[model samples]
Target: MKIHMLPTGDEVHRYQKSIVIPFKNSRKVLSTSPLNGGYRENLLSAFNHDSNPGAGISCSLRTDSYLNDLKLLATEIGLDPATATGISTAASMDNVAIKAVSYENLTVTAIVTGGVEVNGGRVGDPASYHEARGKTVMTKEGTINIILDIDADLLPGTLARALVTCTEAKTAALQELMAGSSYSRGLATGSGTDGTIIIANSQSDLKLTYAGKHSKLGELIGLAVKPAVKEALFLQTGLSPKSQHSMLRRLKRFGITEDGIWNKHGVLGEKTLAKPVFIQQLESVDREEELVALTSLYVHLLDQMDWELITPGRAAQEGRYLVERIKQKYQLDVEYTFSWQSAEETITGMLANFTDVIARISAGGPDV
Candidate 1:
């Protein structure tokens, strides 16, 4: 292990598969770690570990045993096992991102390691039933883990508030990237098994009473965390705005699949073109900026209707208008009729019809 001292006088030990931060002095800590979690005044160190269990290898560490395992790791790293708190992930430690920001007198730092391939999910999405306690069931999958440090003293309640600010910033980052939920037709807020730790300086004389959105501390926390999480995600999984620029990627949240579109194309009796040709043309059109922009608007309309900000009738009207614009712009000879069935049926029919039209247009020409 090699030690690198942070600007806040903390030493970060970088091991091959872990990053450990040992404070020069005991610090105030709050975390969702399975070990040494919750409020603590005498924490000596914090760490993030990568337990990369490969294929056919079991990763689910029993809770009773894993606690001792982490403690053993702590002791090996010259930290007091009784005073160390940490989180774990399958993301590579080499991809960790460290970001720091400062105002006139306050400094905030965020360290993040993120991977959202298998577990990305939105809040309120349906969940699979699982029962476990304290680090048990360590599945070998993606997760986002964050570690935060503040250079100034803060009240215990204020530290808790900082955690909230950090969480919101993380979600905002995922939203900006348009990350899709694994379980629903919604944008992911975070992975299902994410963890976070927030530490504040107990030795500093500058004490803060609040860390809400209005506070400078909160602003710094957001500034540090959002971009750090984004960078870490990109490093771990190649997710970025550029990677999400396709219409298919945008429409995937609505349960749109390539095979679904191809089936819809066959149903329309448009078998003149080969399936490979249709797919090639579809890929070409999927990247068109104007078409993607229209798709984005249509998706937002669906979202607005779902949120009750707009009526289904209004959304259908606007969606059909957008389709007309696409037809005119592309000069395609596709036809669609609106269904006034139940709201669910109407929405489903509209999406099916729209996707079918898109498939026809893609099959018609290369310039579409």
Candidate 2:
């Protein structure tokens, strides 16, 4: 693909391009497919996706049939199916994994999973182990584990851009089910401004399946998986007493019985709780930008979390469950092995802490 940028102004340029792709031993053809949206980014070589993977996106709907046709589709798009590898989900009686193919530009050097569980952190134990971990949330907060690996060249000073592009792509792929949910950086509600991030790198490390690839296959897969991870996040509904206590703790300053925060995207009601799959049934005609905006707001909402309520040492990791499910339901058996960079329970211990937590849970905690 050759891109021609002619100066339209000191800082802006009009872009024109043509991509020549040879298909299945056929002659090369000049393809002039227009990139989505007429605008361009200020960043050099920055690519954005509308988050819609074509051919009706799905992870497990028809695994056998899908994989069988994947090669043909890859060839159609001028991609080498062999390089279209990396992660695959696998399940066993004991555990589930998302395995990577080979090292790509951006590799998965270490994975430090973070989350919260009231049961594990006994009373006053101050289990600081979970403390240092990242991205903690309440019971009502449903989230997914996204093992992302951007191009090594693109990693410099591109944190916010990469995150935005990635989030937008994923949200667009999910379309509706995730419309009600939001995400934040840092630890839960009250934690500092620490967005989801990468911590390490090396000369040789495992690739994140199709991560960091510049290929169209990699791009589509990335967008699809972000929403797919939603299923896993939904399963993380085991509200913790400490997490509840922390969530309710916010009320101490206002001295109110109800949760005051307002952004309420993923709150679950009794019926949805009873019928877990109901969460998946929810759909959206909302645009990709809306979900991306929601995620940005999630980063903003981190200020409300009472970090004091989280156990000191017990960070929780919950994506493996989804990996297993994808394998079981979709036949996408590829285990995920994050560089073992070392890495939850209980509700009723609830009343003991926040008297009104039941009400908040029942009513769906503050959307803010």
Candidate 3:
């Protein structure tokens, strides 16, 4: 919320940068047994058995506006925030960044990202729950793991789609932040041309081989705008005056007005979202510092997989193992492995959703 002043005259306006959101820790509180025991003793017994009453969970986010906006959008679309962790927004700013900061206000104390490392520390809490006769019931009880990341451009408040048009410019400005030598200098560069970067060196050859590797990066960027570009043809004949104007404004950013709907997806293909990559570094020695280590590892692994870029079988395998490890190490209670897809899938699904929205609007337009 405050601007950080640099040694140079100009100010580096850094926002709160990030916030950590915590999952619920409360359990169902049980009523005291009346006939068997008195209220206080009954409550004590329950507590002693590690089945005591639980406090109500706090409503999570620090800002009511965030919680409300998320719930409102979810309600409007008949979506469950829990089920569809992904959201489709035409807003200019990166909704992922905004929501991430918002979630930070709730329960996450610190966050970690990047690949697994011995320094990443062990997953699972050391805290233990005990039952009657003082036997340990659970090593760690009620700890929920959270994995989240943001991908869209500059995060803006809800507005007319005109704001979404601004994403192109906003994203460009954001990329400039990393070019600053302070963050880039000695870090492991992914390749001579590939903008993909890894921060530190590792003895692990898989990482070292790709340390500065940029293979396939350019090819991927070339494919970035395919879906959006493909949707533009519908705009020519089907778009209403207002929608057509919006489409034109977006086209202008990519210089596609001249090329007739060139693939602009290339723009996003250059770099993955900032948050996941940023978190990966933290994941290195993160376990000792935080509880969300599993979530961070999950996101980092998901990033490496790049959901759409990986085969479905590989993705399914990664997803399964990631969930399985969390379950085994943390003893977590989760719905199922299949319930959570790679983060890549979430982004791809989001893009598909955006394309669908554009198509629906085009079909419903007055011109149509």
In Å, residue 309's CA in model 1 sits off its true spot by 1.0
Ranking by TM-score: 1, 2, 3
TM-score of each: 0.92, 0.23, 0.18
What residue runs in model 3 are displaced by over 4 Å at the alpha carbon? 1-291, 304-308, 333-335, 339-368
lDDT tens digits, residues 229-307, model 1?
9999999888888878888988888888777888888888877788888888888788788888999988887777767
For candidate 3, the TM-score is: 0.18
What tens digits encode model 3's per-residue C-alpha lDDT throughout 1-22? 2222211121212212221121
Q: Which candidate is the best by TM-score?
A: 1
Distance (Å) between predicted and true CA of 6, model 2?
40
Candidate that would win on lDDT: 1
- Give lDDT per model, in order: 0.83, 0.26, 0.23
lDDT of 2 by residue, 73-140 (tens): 43444445443211111111011112222233432211111112111111232223463565332211
Model 1's alpha-carbon lDDT is 0.83
> On a 0 to 100 scale, what is the lDDT of residue 200 in model 1?
93
Badly placed stretches (over 4 Å) of model 2 are 1-140, 143-147, 150-155, 158-160, 181-194, 199-224, 237-368
